[model samples]
Target: MSKIYVLDTNVLLQDPHSIFSFEDNEVVIPAVVLEEVDSKKRYMDEIGRNARHVSKLIDRLRETGRLHERIPLENGGVLRIELNHRSFHQLQEIFVEKTNDNRILAVAKNLSLEEQTKENGRAVILVSKDTLVRVKADALGLQAEDFLSDRVVEVDHIYTGELTLYLNTDLLNRFYEKGELSLSELANHPFYPNQFIVMKDALGTSSSAIGIVDHIGKKVKKLVFNHDHIWGIRPRNAQQSMAFELLLRDDIPLVTLIGKAGTGKTLLALAAGLLQTEDLGKFKKLLVARPIVPVGKDLGYLPGEKQEKLRPWMQPIFDNLEYLFNTKKPGELDAILAGMGSIEVEALTYIRGRSIPEQYIIIDEAQNLTKHEVKTILTRVGDRSKIVLMGDPEQIDHPYLDEYNNGLTYVLEKFKDQKIAGHIKLVKGERSGLAQLAADIL
Candidate 1:
């Protein structure tokens, strides 16, 4: 049976193409949702862009037929703008506020009641990204669900970029002696290009070896820079070693590093950027950027010039740079960056529409970006340019994103099968004992 889905304002803002997601079902957009979307269309951020996109989509649909009435969608679904069910009598006692959320709930509740009287009643489900809205919907005895069409993988099942295999002692020893093994030796298991593998003895012995699948997915090769340090930073764990292998390789232009707090993701990327751009001269410059999403209550309207205003937001990047450069004085780091004239640090907002060729780009805190935003950033990559997107998926600050659907995880899963990309999930926190304990338990 075809069901009826009521879309919340956040659903459309999260994904403008959500209208076409429900196939062969009826999608209802309460009138108040339009108002909320209109309110957000004026801002200069991702949310504003999404809101405007939604408005344009709805406007284009309006040209075909009246939105207030049932309109046929391209995907065999029915779309309608519900305007008559705004009455809040049923929710007046429980939810007194005439806010847009309550108004949306009223529409869903009324539709549920109206459908139940018919012999063939379709189920009414309220779809939203807000957890509190779903909770309040359940309190009102309405069927509510999270908008899950954007999720690439479940949080528990997210790819860790590494796999463990138990091999016979002979095969393990052969792999170590030759420094590489053909894909035919590992035919029993499937592997993606550049995926890290830990080969252990099948007989429960202490023998083990670590290697990465080649770019063609046909061989397991030893790490090239497993021993060498980059920019005075060495890999402290197996995962960090794997990250270096990916970061230093010019053939693989895209790399993603996912980890919790203090996993050395940003540090590793910056170190590799410095090594490649400054020491090796492979790239012309090193460009580091991050999305501007505040954690807690934002300190509204920071006072200063452009760089001064950005200093607070970009301080984390500066801290990593300071450690790498060993700058002790207050203005020493700024002088070093200026003197080098090869490293550039800026926000992600100013990166659009620029052709960045022969540059090493690192986007820190990438999990705060949405799918569209990430795509925009990736499309900016020019010839001979490498981009590394590193972030902690669990530490997202974007209101509409989560661990499963954030830009970092989305890219990790989408490029897992490709040859030009590599991913590593750092498990250990090398910052300090206290930071690791907090990341584990807190």
Candidate 2:
């Protein structure tokens, strides 16, 4: 028998196409969900943007049949808007506030009970992203599930973007003796293009050989820039070494770094980019930017030039630069960047329709972006340019995003085995002792 799947507002917001995900099952959209979607539809940010998209999708579906009643979906499923269960009286005994969650729970409970009375009763499952809502459904003996459509992979099993394949003794000797190896030999090596290689002996010993290469037999030489030590920075861990490999590779064109806070993700990318563009003459400029997601407020009404308006959100990028330059004066680093016309930091909002070439682009805080948004950004990359995307999956601020569903995770999961990409998950917190402890305990 086909089951009845009730969708929560968060699930719909996270993925507008979720209504069709149940295949041959019946999909129920509570009337209260439409209210929440309407309120969020006015937003100009990603969440609001997704809300409006969902609204439009549903409206288009209505053209095929009646949505308030039962509408036959093309995928052998029925979609319906349930206004009959708008009352919260059924759940008032347990939840006194009559909150929106309580009303949704009441609908699920009523549906399950009504189905149980019929022959070949359908199973009613409530799908939500909210933890509390799931807990409430379980207490009431109704089936509940988290919408897993967006999760690319399990949290612990997520791709690190870097994989080291152990080579035979002879292969290692040949690489060291000849300074290169054939690409066909690494067919089963489980490495992405631009992936850093640390050739270690299976017997266990030595610092291990470190090198980076492209998929088509081109070697990316290590960067030779002198470190200023202005940011009080160091590699801190092996993952950073891998990150540096991708950062210096001009042929890689695309790089992604994943880690928690204070692992030096953005700092390392910025430093390597500066070395490549300013010191090595490999690229024309170094540009950094991220999506402007306010922690709590919307930025649509903020008034100023693009740079001034973005300053508040992009301050973290500046902080890294200030520390890297080690300038005592406030405007000293700005003058340096202005003199070279080599460094530009802007917002991702206006990146569309722009053809950027021969520059190193670093997109920070990328985990807050959706897969669609990330695709939009990557498609704009011009020739001879490299783009690095870095983010901490645990530190997402997007309302509808989780670890498995965000753009950073999507890229890492989808492009893990492909060439022209490299990834690293930095496990250590190098910011400070206290920062490390906080990342562990808190």
Candidate 3:
């Protein structure tokens, strides 16, 4: 049955392409939503970017036919703008004000009443990324939903880059003897390119082997860096071992690490970055950057210029570097940074419009970015440059992003099949026993 999906301003701001996601269902955009979009169109953030894109899309749609009247969409659907002639009269007094949200709710309520009594008995759903808006919509007797087009996969089901294979003792023996196994050896299990595996004796023997699926998915080869250390920091767990392999490989230019707190995601990347830039000279520079997203209501404002202001925000990176440098006294790490002259730390805000070549770039807290933002950052990489994106998708600071829809998850899912990119999800925490317990229960 066809349904009427009312678009909310947050939905459009979260994703400009959400209008086309409802398939053949009729989409209704509340007039107040456009007003809200207009108000935010001039800002210089992700929301503003999406708002402007939505405006352009609306302008293009206007060429086809009048948007006020019903217009045909390419996906066998119709779209139209809605305005309640009754306006605030139908709104509840409890709502108090005729705010944009209430106005949009009123439009949705008006449509809900109209669609219920239609000859075809269609359904009306309010689509918004705002939790309060969705809740308010429900109170007003309208079905509400979150815009989910960007959520390519569920968080729990995400590809973790490593999987355990319970092979028969004979297969394990064959693998150990031959040093490789064909893809057909495990007929029931399939794997992605570069996916790591822990082959265990299915018969409960202590025998096990660790290997990685080749780029062509033809065979599994033993890990080359199983016992190697990167800048004196070794992998503490199997997942971290997998992460180090991906980070150290020069072939895989793009790598993503997803894990909970204390999983050593950023530490492994930084260690590898240091190894490649300082020791191997594989890259000309080591650049580390992260988005300046605040955890709570922001401190409002901070003093000092960009580099100075970034100190607190980049302190986590600094902490890892200090640990690697084994520095005790103050200014010691500063002296090292000054002496190296090849390490650069900056905010993601300034990374645009710049070509970064022959550099080992690490983008921390990638879960706070959008798919478009990641694409922009990746395009800036020049020849011989490698980018490592590390983040715990479950701990995103961006209000509009979640584990499944953030840029980290997006890239990890989209590039799973590509040979040039590799991903791993670290489950075990290595920070401290207390930290791991708190991460699980808290």
For each candidate in turn, the TM-score is 0.98, 0.88, 0.96
Q: List the residue pairs that clash in candidate 2.
A: 193-419
Q: What is the C-alpha RMSD of each candidate to the true structure, in Å?
A: 1.2, 3.5, 1.5
* Candidate 3 local lDDT, 1-442, one digit each (tens): 8888988888888888888888898999988888889999998999899999999999999999998998899988888987553377668675879888888888888777777787888888988888999999888878998887879794468888988889999889888998899978776677889998899999898999888899998899887675476788988988888888898898899999988999998889899999889999999999999999989878767799877889988999999999999999998998999999999998999989999999999999999999999999999999999999989888988878888999988999999999898988999999999999999999
Task: Show model 1 residue runs off by greater than 4 Å.
Answer: none
Pairs of residues at least 3 apart in sequence or in different chains that clash in candidate 1: none
Best by lDDT: 1
lDDT of each: 0.93, 0.82, 0.89
For residue 218, model 3's alpha carbon misses the true position, in angstroms, by 0.8
Superposed model 2: Cα runs more than 4 Å off = 164-171, 180-190, 211-236, 294-309
Report the number of backbone clashes for model 1: 0
Tens digits of per-residue lDDT for model 2, 9-44: 999888888898899999999988999999999887
Give the distance in Å from residue 116's predicted Cα in candidate 2 to where it truly belongs: 1.2
Q: Which candidate, 1 or 3, would have the higher lDDT against the true structure?
A: 1
Clashes (backbone N, CA, C under 3 Å), per candidate, total 0, 1, 0
- Cα lDDT tens digits, model 1, 1-442, are 9999999999999999999999999999999999999999999999999999999999999998999998999999989999999999889999988989999999999999999999999999999999999999999999999988889995578888899988898899899899999878876778999999898999999999899898788899987775476788988998998899899998899999999999999999999999999999999999999988888999999887889988999999999999999989999999999999999889998988988999999999999999888999999999999999999988988989999999999999999989999999999999999999999998
The predicted structure with the larger TM-score, 1 or 2, is 1
